[model samples]
Target: MSKIALFGASGTIGSRVRREALDRGHQVTAVVRDPRKITEEHPALTVVTGEVLDAASVAAVAEGHDVVVSAVGGGDGPGHQATIKPAAEVLVEGLRSLGTDAPRLIAVGGAGSLRTPDGAQVWDADGLPEFVLQIMHAHGDALDFYRTVGDVRWTCLSPAAQIEPGERTGRYRTAVDDLIVGADGQSRISAEDYAVALVDEIEDPRHVGERFTVGD
Candidate 1:
């Protein structure tokens, strides 16, 4: 079983990812700002106080873990500009301090940078609110940062256009950069299934040192 370190474990997507990992018989360390926020109980789960933007804290929690999953700002909008890109930098910096023994990093990404069927990007679509644009761009910026780093073993998984709490069919399609549009012309994936894909990736390495998106 893989020893996983997870940031933002109290958030929507993070909680689902934690549950998925624990259900798969993996050991999970739920790192959060407030440990009391994580109310779930699992034999393989351990909650701890930590900050995603702090390299020291990241290193402390990341050491000895097989994978470090960051779900920070995965489904938020208010202050993503401050956390998303900065968190990416801190995570890489912390992991780099460990040299060659650092665990692999899997960061939750956004769909804004994905190319649409017409070749335009998702963030280029009209009628998007200003705050929504900020969050999307924040993730885009983080992805851009990840691409520049060749030393760290990192994988960014971007969700589809729409993601919310739903059933997990344990099935989804994936793409490297283009948006995965189904036959109905809609791009979407339930958060549960997204966790399934993330854990599946952890179990089987693919798209290493790159980004990929998922959809129903």
Candidate 2:
């Protein structure tokens, strides 16, 4: 079983990933700000309380892991959606301080930056709603940061345009640098399946130093 250090373990996608990892018999170190929020207890799971934006804190929790996954998201409040970039920066710095790049990093990214078949970014698509623009921009910045960073072996997994709580079919399709649309012409995936894809990638490395998207 691979050792995984997961940030934002109490969030929607993070929680799913944590469960999937444990179900697959992997050792998971779930890093969260509040340990009480994560009530799931597993023999293979270790909960660590720390700040994702602090380099030292992140590094301390990330030590001795085979892979690091960040499933962080912006909170409900307005303008709080831009934390992904800062968190990415801190994660990179923390990983670099380890003095060895053994633990590869994978981040849960937004689908707004994904490219359509016509080559237009989802963020720039016509008639896009204004409310989600900030979150999209933040995720775009985070993806850009990962793309440009050289020291860390990182990959950003962008989910389908519409992600929600649904059944885990343990099945999905993946595409690199472009959006994956279903037969019905919509891009979507369940949170549980997204976690499945992530843990699958963790077990077998693909899309290294790049971004990939998942869809039903």
Candidate 3:
């Protein structure tokens, strides 16, 4: 089984990914600021208390793993927003310091930077809300940073326009550089299905060094 070091394990997406990974027989180290926040327990799971922004702490926990999945989210407050870039920067640096290239990194990204049918960015759509604009800008910045860093094998997986807790059908469509819309003209995917896709990718590496989107 592959060893995975997951940051932000207490978050929504991270927790789902942790469960999916463990269910697939992989060993998972859930890194979070508060250990009590994670309620689920599995034989293959180990919870560790740490900060993702701290390079030293990240490096310590990420030292020996087959893959690293970062599901950290941008906070609600204005000042706390724009966290993805900083967290990604520290994660890359921390993984590099380990002096090994075994573990590949996968980052859960946002859909704002994704392209529409007319080749326009979703974030740039007309009449977009101000709060959404802020988060999108940060996500765009984080994706941009990933594009420039070549020393590590990283993949940014952006979900559909709407993601929430739902059933795991294990059925979805994948696309690159553009948003995926269903037959109903809606762009969305269940969180469980997204986790399935992520774990599938973790087991079988594809779309490496690039960004891909998923939808139902």
Candidate 4:
């Protein structure tokens, strides 16, 4: 089983990922900002408290873990701080300090960057709300910084056009360069199934240096 040093374990996506990891029998060192904030506990899980923007602190938590998964979000307040450019910089450098070949990193990226019909990004689509485009640009900027650095073993997962809580059917389409949409034209994917995709990628390496999106 893969030994994972998980960041953002307290959030929605992270929580599901954590449960899925446990179900798969992998050991998880849950790196959170506050260990006491955890509402549930698992024997296979270990909690470490610290900030994600501190490379040294993050590296310390990363020691002995095979891979690192970050389910960081950029919403209002605390989420915004975590999703801002600084968070990406911190993680990029932190992963680098893990010594060139240690701890493969997987980041939770936004779906805004995905392509839409006629070749424009989803966020750039016609009549898209201004606020939505704003955050999408923010995530694009974060990932842009990541491209300038090397020595970081990393890949990003962009879920289906829409991601929310639902059942885990383990049934979803995978794509390398484009977002997957159902026949009806809406792209929605369950968080549980997304967890399945993430953990499966953790177990078997694929789509390195490439971006893949999943949907129903």
- Clashes counted in candidate 4 amount to 0
lDDT of 2 by residue, 1-216 (tens): 999999989998999999999999999999999899999889999999988899999788888899999999846567666678999999999998987755889999999999998899889887765658888888999888898988889999999999988999999999998999988989999999999999999999988899999999
TM-score, candidate number 4: 0.92
Question: Candidate 3 lDDT, tens digit per residue, 163-186?
Answer: 988999999999998999888988
Give model 3's TM-score versus the native structure. Answer: 0.96
What candidate 4 gets wrong by more than 4 Å, as runs, is 74-82
Better of 2 and 3 by lDDT: 2
TM-score sort, best first? 1, 2, 3, 4
What does candidate 2 score in Cα RMSD to the true structure? 1.2
Per-prediction backbone clash count: 0, 0, 0, 0
Question: Candidate 4: lDDT over CA atoms?
Answer: 0.80
The TM-score values for the models, in the order shown, are 0.98, 0.96, 0.96, 0.92
Ranking by lDDT: 1, 2, 3, 4
Best by lDDT: 1
lDDT of 4 by residue, 1-216 (tens): 999988888887888899999999999988888888676778898888967888898788877788988887645432463365677788777777878557888877777888875577778777766666666777777777766766777778888768898999988888865768888989889999999999999999896665677788
Candidates 1 and 3 compared: the better one by TM-score is 1
